[model samples]
Target chain A: MTSIAIPRPAYAERPWILDWLMTVDHKKLGILYLYTTMFFFAVGGILALLVRTQLAVADNTFVNNDAYNQIFTMHASAMLFLFIIPVWAGFGNYIVPLQIGAADMAFPRINALSFWLIPPAGLLMFSGFLFGGAADAGWTAYSPLARGSGVGLDLWIISVIILGVSSTIGAANFMVTMFRMRAPGMTMFRMPIFCWTMLVTAVLQLLATPVLASALAMLYIDRNFGGSFFDPNGGGNAILWQNIFWFYSHPAVYIMILPGMGIISEVLPVFARKPLFGYKAFVFATMGIGGLGFSVWAHHMFTTGAVLKPWFGFMTFMIGVPTGVKMFNWLGTLWRGSITFEAPMLFALGFLSMFLIGGINGTFSAAVPVDFAIHDTYFVVAHIHYVLFGGAVFAVFAGLYYWFPKIWGRRLDERLARIHFALQFIGFNLAFFPMHLLGLDGMPRRIATYSESSGWETLNLISTIGAFLIGVAMIPFIINVVMAFLRPKDQPNDPWEANTLEWWTTSPPPVHNFDSLPEVHSERPLWDLRHGKTAH
Target chain B: MASHAVATQHKQGLSNGMLGFILFLASEVMFFGGLFAAYFIARADAREWPPEYLLTPEQVASGVKLEVEFWLPFIATILLVLSSVTIQFAVFSIQRGNRSGLIRWTFVSIVLGLVFLVMQVYDYSQLHFGVGDTIYGTTFYTMTGFHGLHVAGGVIFMGIILARSLAGQFTAANHEAVEACSFYWHFVDVVWIALFTTLYIIP
Candidate 1:
């Protein structure tokens, strides 16, 4: 028997900085995204802690009113634009090519460009804090308030537009890569659900992001050029701002969560030791969620009195059906299989449970009466944090654990990861769950302080403690990553015994992913490999 | 040395440039869609569509200016649309190993694209309302301005393909660059037709 030798190329000799600057390799860009997103995550996390601390004691003078506003506003902006979206794009860029058995993303140079735009956008946004007060209007930056603010708001607008450009370019690349670059046998139906969800997400980004860019440009014109796109006195309608903003912003929420859902979809099946329970249903549910996402933007405008309440209310409730179907599907995937409570699995479970609570709270807000009562309160804050942090961030962690081996070719410290998950789950709930009560008790959101007699002091303190616990939880996870990176270890090609085709490739796959493209005959090509069935 | 052979073992598939063009067009769709939606919503709610109060007496007196009189754009649009056909012919000719035919059509297509762009610039000069005049001006200018930018991009692409054809870089067996450029030129032509009908003929 003759054995064929596959030649390995020596690593290219280049200076470190120049290598990163010019390289089109997806993995390098992915690492760049990871480090950049983590940096922003830390900054945003600190801002979150500051907000929590100020709210910890009623009538507290931890920071002045203006400073508190800047802290919370930048926190939301940083977390949403700079951290969550970029991190997910980073992951998608790194993994989707491997998942589909492609050598590299279809447009590798554009992928590099997409990753490069993010840090500059983050800098432009955060630089405002040092120069003046950061944007005081919330991340949503509703018109009259955003318009009324100073140069900081202008900076926020510019930064968001830049980020939108980055997202749009990245999404365009993802869509093209998914459509044209799949391996010979990797049919669309046979592709991993993560890739499918990303495909949907890229479509949404391509279609929706430019609207936000246009809206922001209008806002800029109104702010600086004496245009009247939003100024009521200048024959402009403020509701126009809400309509246009939410048109993009509603789908923007999906942009944050759909990838997380994709992560959970990938994670649950592996832990359950089964093919995904409802593969087609899950795919349809993703599209359904994305499709219905556009119709419910008016729900965000319930307080504004310009929309038809009954119609918006009904559509908002309708959004729950597809979301609920996804919950059931995730649970069904875990129903009877030999379930393992690995760190990634645990985070997936946390995401499911916490997202349910967030979904239910969202439904409550859909009711016009309930929304009117809690419109500007801490309840909305709690609900959003539960959704964004508990749902999306948890799923992000799950993906990190699940794919860490594939990217780095080493196992992250399992013990440290589990410890990190426990602290985060507990601390996350402790921090955010009480805000619902404080909100129902009439503590309005975005306020810098409250009177000592407001009856919200103890809960606020507990939330602050939880915030610090989250900070502590992050320490071990960071240490684990550093340790794993410094002393690299080899992992088996299929570390998770997973069903997906991505597991078929070498860990830290070759620059061109496959030596020869593998033919994909089923959703679980790797499963077929294990079963002694030739997938090609 | 063996690594170079391994890298080239997989026959180079289509150029990534085609993917870039498709992606660019998808984003352009959203950009135009947003403007169209804004125009529709504004037109729907206004007591007087296009707000007669906002128009100048001369523009109003001219009985709606028959948006078609932006006829220079029509000429530009025709030129662009014909260029798409010529580019495709060039692509087909290349596929049949007809080198001279490919070069001839490629040069023709480039000339048509350049002419289209020149006409577009002339049309911009004749506009009665500037981008800052009113909402009508804003919508009109932004939509066509972006489309003009796309046309400009197509012209640059055509120029590149023309240069490559002249250099004998593309063979009959592998002309992905020609195919990709033709696809983009066709897309630009389609977008112009849609813009012309919606912005001019439909009203």
Candidate 2:
């Protein structure tokens, strides 16, 4: 390869620690984002274990009520803000430029700033623990209750706003990089499916996240400056906060999952030995989901009765149409093909089945009557875990395993990966599946204790065991990664025989990202390059 | 290799910097959109403009009229609108390779923006209603106060633009910052028009 001909810059000789701390290189920054977000993931997972242990049996005194609230709230906060959202940015920052055959992100320094904001914000959010207790008002931070929480809640508000800024700028950077920086022949249509999803996700972040910032600001003012934005006694409406928060958050649900869908799309066709079915259809369906995401924010508020229930209900159901399209797109990509069950593919299939259930169960809440039954119950919690944990988390690992060789120039042990996948798949279902029964039995969420006669102890205990199993699942993954790193940079350019431009370059490609380029003829540019250009 | 990237970036017609700035403004729109939606929701829920029963008797006794007085804010609005025009002139000036013209118009725009901010501060001082008075006071101040902050931000943005202009940093061929600053200034102005209509004129 001609990569050796490229000269190293003066700054490349900096101390490795200073190199990491002050680097503006997208690849290094992407690694920083991944490491930081994974650290938070571990922290969030520990908190989840605490939550499960507390709820394992009726009237459990593992943790008292106050600590339990903070535990669960911080669990969701850390997982969603610190892990799921920015994890995508991590993947995008590393992969998008490479896939598009660009040298680096369009605004490389701004890209660094986007990543740097996250760690401090995360520290600030968790710093509440050192003060008194962390924010216990739930990750949603519903008004009235949120208004009265301690300084911890204020810290949460600021942390979220900081996170929102990080993502907002990051979103614009992604949009610009994807939109303006694709290779010569790569039209928007020819761009990789993952980049397309990141594009839609960026649009969502650019538009929806700032609304969340505004909501956080209002909540802050209400708490500190005696503003009455959410205080009903002051002639302000409590539900206004929900309206604004859900407006951002409902789309945020898509922000959390769409890139996962993108990952599944990229992985399926590669392992299946066929191009993705209905690639254009998948792209439009993605755009459809993003557009429809805004209208359905009010669906989260239907139990409040302040919104027009029928309109929101219909819009909520309508969102399922686009989501359903992408599901079929995935299934169609897999049907009647020589599919492999490698680690990435294993997680991809897990995403398909679990995210399918996640989608179907979500449709249940679109029915206003059903939502009335399940709102704020374990069932709602079940739906979130199924989608976020099952869908997004699975895709996250899929992308990680798929790109592991490329990012680090070594392959993860597939045997350990399969073990990791199996334990997680089983543990995930065991942990969350019982919530369906518990919610149907009218066991509410966010409760610190339940009576011995509540009949929830068995299911809760089972779920706790499953949550631990999920924690156990991480051991194989960690071992696999450490073992790989101890070896050497021995991977070839196309380790997975992948179908995009990223695979056309060397694993852990040089500082300029590419030493040479391939002509892009279709979505599967590498595939076409291999197959004598039959693509059209 | 780097030069090759610059070639493709311009294929979109909008430079990456300008396109990104526009998207940034789009987010700013949504931010204010949230505040406006809150204002309207608060207005719809209240039977009285100020929801007088919720007001403190002390507030009433201290001469809080529960009203948004007009003329001062109206004049401030005009200054902001004119500043928007002057910034556009700055952009156009640079586009024609007129260095002195760019500096002169940008300097004028900065003055207009600062005066508008001062007028807003003075207007804020004349108001008897505090942010804690009621939802009326809260929404009004939050929405307009945030807009005031953005205006101050725009002035700072123009300050940098002016300094760059004097340094001969921008030419007719490459003055994306001038264009970006104009877009941001216009967005601030447009948000103000909305705030003025809703908070000052609507009732």
- Which prediction has the highest lDDT against the true structure? 2
User: How would you encode candidate 1's per-residue C-alpha lDDT over A1-536 as one tens digit per residue?
Assistant: 12235654444567778888878888888879988998999999999999988888888999998898889999999999999989989889888887877667777888888888888888888788877778998888888988888788888899998899889989988887887777776778888889988988988888889888878877787677655566544335678878888989999899999999999999998999877888888888889988988888888889899999999899889889988889988889999989998889999999999999999998999999999999989999999989999999999899999998888898898899999999999999999999999999988999998888888999999989989999999999999999988876688878899877667767877666655544578777877767788844
- For model 2, the stretches where C-alpha displacement exceeds 4 angstroms are A1-4, B1-8
Candidate 2 lDDT, A1-536, residue by residue in tens: 54345557788899989999888888989899999999999999999999999998888899999999999999999999999999999999999999888888989889999999999999999999999989999999998999999999999999999999999999999999988888878889999999999999999999999999999999999999999999988899999999999999999999999999999999999999989999999999999999999999989888898899999999999999989889888889899979989999999999999998899899999999999999989999999999999999999999999999999999899899999999999999999999999998999999998999988999999999999999999999999999999998999999888899989888888778776787788989888977889548
What is the total number of backbone clashes in candidate 1? 2
List TM-score per model, in order: 0.88, 0.98
| Clash-forming residue pairs, model 2 | none
Each model's number of backbone clashes?
A: 2, 0
Model 2: per-residue Cα lDDT at residue A53: 91
- Candidate chain B TM-scores, in order: 0.81, 0.94
Q: List the residue pairs that clash in candidate 1.
A: A103-A513, A185-A520
